[model samples]
Target: MSWAIIQQSLPMFGKGFELTLWLSFVGIIGSIVVGLICSLVQYFRVPVFRQIASVYVEISRNTPLLIQLFFLYYAFPVLGIKFGAQLCGIIGLIFLGGSYMAEGFTGGFNGVSKSQVESGKAIGLSRWQLARYVVFPQGFSLSVPAMAANVIFLIKETSIFTVIAIPELTNTALDLIGMYYRSNEYLFVLVIAYAIILVPLSIILTLLEKRVRYGTFGN
Candidate 1:
């Protein structure tokens, strides 16, 4: 591990880090939105949408993110649908992450007490009102730990974006190693770079989980 090589490579890694952060941020938000909608559809057992959401969750969760990215970046263009590398990476992350998030959220939604749901209905609360006043709050609280895990998972998944030519952390490290043949130095930095982003994120998520747990259960 040459310190000089590590130091020299910081600028390239910085750019890659920024791109990775951007991709992860966008992917996380998009996945959460998609997941919430799907979970709600499933939870409410919406006629056609419930089946669609179920099939979508199965397909997205079963498929690999790399394959998704390949289809978006390579195969789509053959049919006149075109997406840039970055866009493909973002879409791939959202496509993959959304399924997992949906499952997590569904589990949370299902954990809501049946009696409480009945009570809400007994009070003449409509489906939307029950969802807003009774279900979503408790469900979201129950799902926080799982959601945090998914966020970290999605962030780590950004490493594979390199295959789609996204200039993210892993790509920058690989490029430097190819040019300088300093695999140890570059790889060391790559690991550290990821740690820099994920470690604090994990800690923060842990704290958030504890807070939510305390707030929800009074424990």
Candidate 2:
């Protein structure tokens, strides 16, 4: 409960939090892109790509992210293939989040009404035109809640990067605990830091969802 120690360690926590934010941002974007592409192909029933997307989602979803990170960071090194710890952590998050995102997006795509699609076809919309103009916007709108939940989960999961010494928030907290021998203080800080970041994000997503539900993207 030493305020002084906590104050001094603020810089360290800031650095770790910055890295965590960077990882989360990049991971979210990568996951969304990967998920959207995978969902789209599977939704359209594209030949080989659809199968590949299925396998990717199945394997990524079934496996523990910890094991995936271990394989990439540890096992790969043994085979003379290597990635930096941060890179491996980012890649693991992307794969894991992308799997969940794919499922969410696929559900969203299915939620679109069949008659709307038929109407698009009757209007002579090309397949790409149908998807781009009519389907993706509505599908993405439907997916927003699930997508927000997945993003929050992915941000929290960034704590696991500590296992690979990625120096995210948890790792910084651990370091402070070792230095000050006050685990409770640092743990409190960790909780506050996460709350600070996640609470606002959750609120913003909620507002966005409401806007989407009302057919307004917002001002």
Candidate 3:
């Protein structure tokens, strides 16, 4: 392991880390929004949207994320759409992660007791009002820990963006390896950098998951 190579590559790794975090941030937010919309539409059986959401969830869940990224980055331009590599990566993460998140949310939404629905109905609450005031809160609490796990997976998956030449951590490490001809050291450092971000997140999410399960989340 070449400490000299690793030391020299630190700055590039720092920049790469920043970009990875940015993509993760955008991906997590987008996935949650998309997932919630998909889950809600499916849960409520909203007219046309329910069917569309079903198809989207099916395709996104079944497909490989790398293929999705390729389609977004490579195929879209052939059909007259264009986006930067980072944007393509972010879009892919949202599309793929959102499908899994939708499933998580669907499970959570379903976990809400039938009695809650009946109670809302007894109070003359409209469908939207019940969802907004009661169901969504409980569903969100149940789903967030699962969604946090998805966020971690999505962040790691962003390394695939290097294929499109997005300067994420893996790309940075690869570049350093190529420049210094020391793959082992660079790869080792790369793993450490990723762990730095993901480890704490995993611990926090574990705590939150326990809180949610024990009915002490908000307190």
How much lDDT does each candidate structure score?
0.93, 0.92, 0.89
Give stretches of model 3 more than 4 Å off: 215-219
Cα error of candidate 2 at position 31, Å: 0.8
Cα deviation of 126, candidate 3, in Å = 2.9
Q: Model 2 — which ten-residue stretch has the worst lDDT? A: 210-219
Clash statistics: count for each candidate: 0, 0, 0
Each prediction's TM-score versus the true structure: 0.96, 0.94, 0.92
Off by over 4 Å in 1: 216-219
- Flag clash pairs in model 1: none
How many Å off is the CA of 156 in candidate 1?
0.5
Best by lDDT: 1
Local error of candidate 3 at residue 163 (angstroms)? 1.0
Give the lDDT of residue 26 in candidate 1.
98
Error of 3 at 37 (Å): 1.4
Counting only residues 3 or more apart in sequence or on different chains, how many pairs clash (N, Cα, C under 3 Å) in candidate 2? 0
TM-score of 2: 0.94
Residue 118 deviation, candidate 1, in Å?
Answer: 2.5
lDDT of 2 by residue, 149-203 (tens): 9999999999999999999999999977887788988998899999989999999
Residue-level lDDT tens digits of model 1 in 13-108: 999999999999999999999999999889888899999999999999998898999999999999999998998999899999989999999988
Ranking by TM-score: 1, 2, 3
Which residue runs of candidate 2 sit more than 4 Å off their true CA positions? 217-219
- Preferred candidate (lDDT higher): 2 or 3: 2
Query: Which whole-number lDDT from 0 to 100 does residue 53 have in model 1?
Result: 92
